[model samples]
Target chain A: MRVENYSFVFAVFFANVFAWNPTPQVIEEQVPQTAFAQLLDFQNAARPEYNAYLSAGIIYLPLPSQSALLTEWGTHNGFAFRQRIGIWLTDNFDGKGSKGITFGLGWFGERQGWDNEDFLFVPNRGNFSQINQIHSWGLTIADSSKHWLFGGGLQYLNAKDESFRWWLLGTWSRFSIMPNFHKGDLQFINAQLFLQARELLGNENSWQNYLPDLEFSFYTKDSVKIFVSQNIFKQKYYLEGAFWARPQDFAYAALKFYPDPSRLLLALEATATKKDNDDIYFGGGITLPFLRVAYNHADDYESFFKSRGIWIVEIRLAIGSSGDSFFALKAPKAAPKEVKRIPMKKANFNSNNGE
Target chain B: MKSVKFLFLLLLGAFFSSCTHWLIDTETRIQVKNSTNRDIYELSVISPGKRIVLVPDTLKVDESSNVHVISWVGKFKFAIFVKNLPDSVYLGEYELKGGSIKAEIKGEDMALKMVLK
Candidate 1:
């Protein structure tokens, strides 16, 4: 069998054991019970005037060596599983100008699985039986007032194996100012910066560093948004444009045909130093009641564990205490006071009837 | 022969001494649903090392009313452990009634509605 095929089979076996079966149980047992549940409910509420959300996903990458066997004895080589969770704190979480200032925290863990003979980061190329595990955490803060949205965050990562240890510190910040333009078209200017530091905290001899990233996005209308970003230091640049329809639930069958609840996105990225390495990416996806799927060319497999590229598929299954209400593709518009007041009475009436 | 041996040693040393590491960012979303007949009055997310202190450890439910009101707030601290690092964690609240749930953090408002499954 080819290397990729063997990797797929091994991946399926481990995936069945690790990713699919254990997640449901873990989620069920870990569901919170208290004000936190209320916070989650609020975050998930449709038309959340202001809200925050926290989520986690895991990605797996199998090594090529795992596909080939030695002798007749079949030995399975392990793959890398990168796990990440993020808290999306957004003021005006509903996207309506109802609230401001939201904070989020994201934490991640990446484990590199390799056999004793294949371990790479060893002193004097020594053989190490243990695998390497890395841990990282990030925090994002956004403050959105009447006309402006500003946010920033940092990430710290530490990795260790039998032979060596490494550490990295990265920082990112973004500012977006929305200016009142002519009818229906909202114009905005955005700026972003990213910086990173790498060091061998344990051995001290092995170290490297990089600092690159900046970009801007312009929201022209409800259906059109354009952005350009570049890493001035690294001389790399990218342009991206996206078109999305107004949000509508499947229940509103007639309304669906009007806006076409789908998205088309195009992006091009190139390195000034080596423009030949440039890559162009195009993707389109749909939003449905049961699942959400999207395809993208630039796959962040290393960071997100998910694939990105020519043909990528993303499938999400909505399973939580709340049903379709939890995942809002876009913020909901504000409801008038009279409309808001009715639910309070309805809740009270339900309680009374139950009694 | 001596020069060839020296070149081989240099290549081996260079390969063993150099290392590279990649930094990645991941996002996870968690959804919680309430199926019980009773209104879920409160929700809290607790990490492995954190303590939850409820001013009143218990709730008093009115025997004749199905409404549940949780009116208490306490601080909890989460400590990072090498093995217990969680990718994402969240707590949510839902009013069994057909209204929106709201959480305000740093002045941002997030509203959600509860749907009966």
Candidate 2:
């Protein structure tokens, strides 16, 4: 199994539960591919995402009815096209506190083509070109507190057949955790992947998860945060080992530039990769009302699609007056009134006309 | 007004200082039943991480008490000291999947048959 996108700087926070170790010295992995996760991360199109409540590239807060859409095309060995749409559920659309029984739904799809030699190793080698496709959907619901969000959801991973996972997310103060539970065929698939990996690389430990994947964060002042996460990327017919969260899963810095919490001027971030070799990821984004533009360098983005790093774009609008709740950037405070006073004519001891 | 402002800041600081522990330590519990004929002197459940006394004093013959318990993967034992025994009889090194476990002790010799429920 090839591990998928461990490339996102934003996804490390709302990552999932994990408990298992794969065999070491697996076959030299194929260059990775990009998917809908990178596009909807929002940071993929912009520098930084400023919401404290949203974790795992997702929002868990009570929201006024909100809709978000993201689409992108990038170059690697080939070109890849992906799209994502999200609907934040809420009862009151009167635009008060975008707070109801907060839940969200996101649908994502990826379309591209690659040769088996590029992505997989078959026992019997064959020259075959395959249309690599990915389709997945997620449903999340959160219980929101002033400084916390706790919820669980189900995800459908579009593989050879649809595989499902149960994941949970919790954010407290500046700390967040997500645990993913695996059951049914995934465990079996994990075992198969482990055996294949062990066979390919002699001297490797085969392990499977009976528990969750984990993502952790320590949020600090000025939007500087740390994220440690492990996300298992499931491809069409197999689980890729290369995409596993590696040596380390931490984003050292996420900096957003805004006077206060609204009208973010710029967002800047840097993340070190989890692989043995050091690959520094640099990305930044700008938020304008409902529009965002971002530049990011993901290894998969370069290898699979042969695409540049700056084409991820998104438009996110939360229609509500409750400032900074559903929205990351609240309206800028009204400019302070300029002090103006008429200049009084100076009194002269000796006036031109007799005093 | 200045004092008020200072007090407010002080309270905010204290509140945030311990925010990590603000939530209660959530736990799971189990009910211990004394199905044996004799009155129980005491009962303690021993897991790797915890040693909880399910009954502190003389528990009546048929009485039961709800007790907080932590079940580890292994090395989990139940100890019982009854009216006639010289020492507590250790029940098991049982593997637990958490939730609850039952310890059935033969009333006469204190031979125990414990299973997870």
Candidate 3:
């Protein structure tokens, strides 16, 4: 049933894309070259500014190892459509230093269709179900100084029907094992080691685990970044790699290109384990100034895709002071504003029943 | 210097100890205890469209099986069928509020109790 709906959505999406009058490439070409440079400069200069933002999107990712231990308790591990809304506030505490704190709150409701009867025990009529709705709030503090960066997040979750409940408290510190250096023309490498301790709060007893990870990033002068991370924590050990490239400035206004890989993102991550529970995940996204279209795929997702495969699509719009400053118009231009309203009047009517 | 070393060691020990204390009040498991004279022929978990068959198919009298009913949210229901019984003995619903939950099946009436460990 959901698959049919998804097909209709995709059809509408493509139709709207084709109907766009002046596409993104046309808009890019209208801006002057100098404006692009100014946009990058302004973005770098505003990095430390305080800002707040709100975004809505869909996400289907497994909870971390600790909370996921609920699976041992018989909680279903499956992919569900999550309609999520999130808001965040960030501020640079120190006026001049690289230290800041962020507070965030999010809520999402998830529902999945069970088409496969193999795993169903009831197999009753009209059995489409919804997973637990969750509300979460978190705070993070970070400081990057002396070749070391540290951050910690304390998150709390409340699920509907009290089926699931837990808190995730984690702290991580990163040391710059190798700073960015020029290996060749337009080539650089940066490496970091991250150590973290995550504590999981259950209704009975709490447990904590320590994780150690290494991250390496290779980038060119053209703003294309390729990065990889290797993480080994308790029940999870995975190696992930990603590539992201900056969008190009267009020279032609009339002709537009679809599926721009340069401005797109692709990632592949895998968890290594001897058990059948080993997982491989794929994520991809197309990013614009304040808009994002992303999708994630997993092999072992049980809810919607099940064994065939799972695809989660997300579309979001975000607004912030500095988030879109680089993408906003170069010069501030004002247009005439107009307002129209019709005055309201009351009317009285009389009716006779004798006739 | 000796005091500083002692404190460092104490902190390390505390950290390790906390890591081992995994089952806190937030996560819980469930168990099924049969106190009736008749044996349970089949026990199945019923949630909306899905049903899970608990293993060890038969539960003899006075026998208990550790059933993993992980509830991050709240309560769920199950059904118990006695040997050769035409109808099911429905266990309305049970919740693991803070710790482990035990569903004591006594003849026709099932009682739920929580055990905090």
Model 1, A1-355: lDDT tens digits are 3546655744553342322111122222221111112222222221112244444333322332222111111122222232333344443444444345445443333333323122233412112122334333334343433322222222222223121112112112122222222234332322233222211111122221223222323333342222232222212122222222322111000001102111111112221110112333333334343333333322232122222331222222221111112323221111112334443434443466545
Ranking by DockQ: 3, 1, 2
Writing each residue's lDDT as its tens digit, candidate 3 over A1-355 gives: 3445655754543332211121122222322221222222222112223233344544332211111211212332222233445444455322333334433222222222211011112322112223323333334333322122222222222222232222222222233322221122322333434433211101111132234333433344565433333333231333344334433321111111112111122223332211123344333334453344433322122112221122233444433333222111111111112356687775545646665
Task: Kindly report, for each predicted structure in the order presented, the TM-score of its chain A compared with the true chain A.
Answer: 0.33, 0.40, 0.32
> Which TM-score value belongs to model 1?
0.28
Which stretch of 10 consecutive residues in model 2 chain A shows the poorest summed lDDT? Answer: A61-70
Q: What is the DockQ of candidate 3?
A: 0.02
lDDT: the better of candidates 1 and 3: 3
Native interface contact recovery, all models: 0.00, 0.00, 0.00
- Scanning candidate 2 chain B in windows of ten residues, the lowest lDDT window is B19-28
Stretches > 4 Å off in candidate 1: A1-50, A60-76, A89-153, A160-296, A300-355, B1-117
Q: How do the residues A1-355 of candidate 2 rate in per-residue lDDT, one tens digit apiece?
A: 1122322432442222121111111111111123323222321111111122221111111100011101111011111122224333322222244544454443334333332111211211222223334443444443333434444455555433445655444544334444444563221111101111211112132332211222222221222222222212210011111232233343233343444322333333232233234445554445454455444423323323322233344333432212133323122221223469899999887766743
Top-DockQ structure, candidate number: 3
**What would the per-residue lDDT of candidate 2 be over residues B1-117, giving only the tens digit for each residue?**
567557556644543232211221112245556667776656676545455565565656767655645322123366777777786767655544333555444454476544445
TM-score per model over all chains: 0.28, 0.33, 0.28
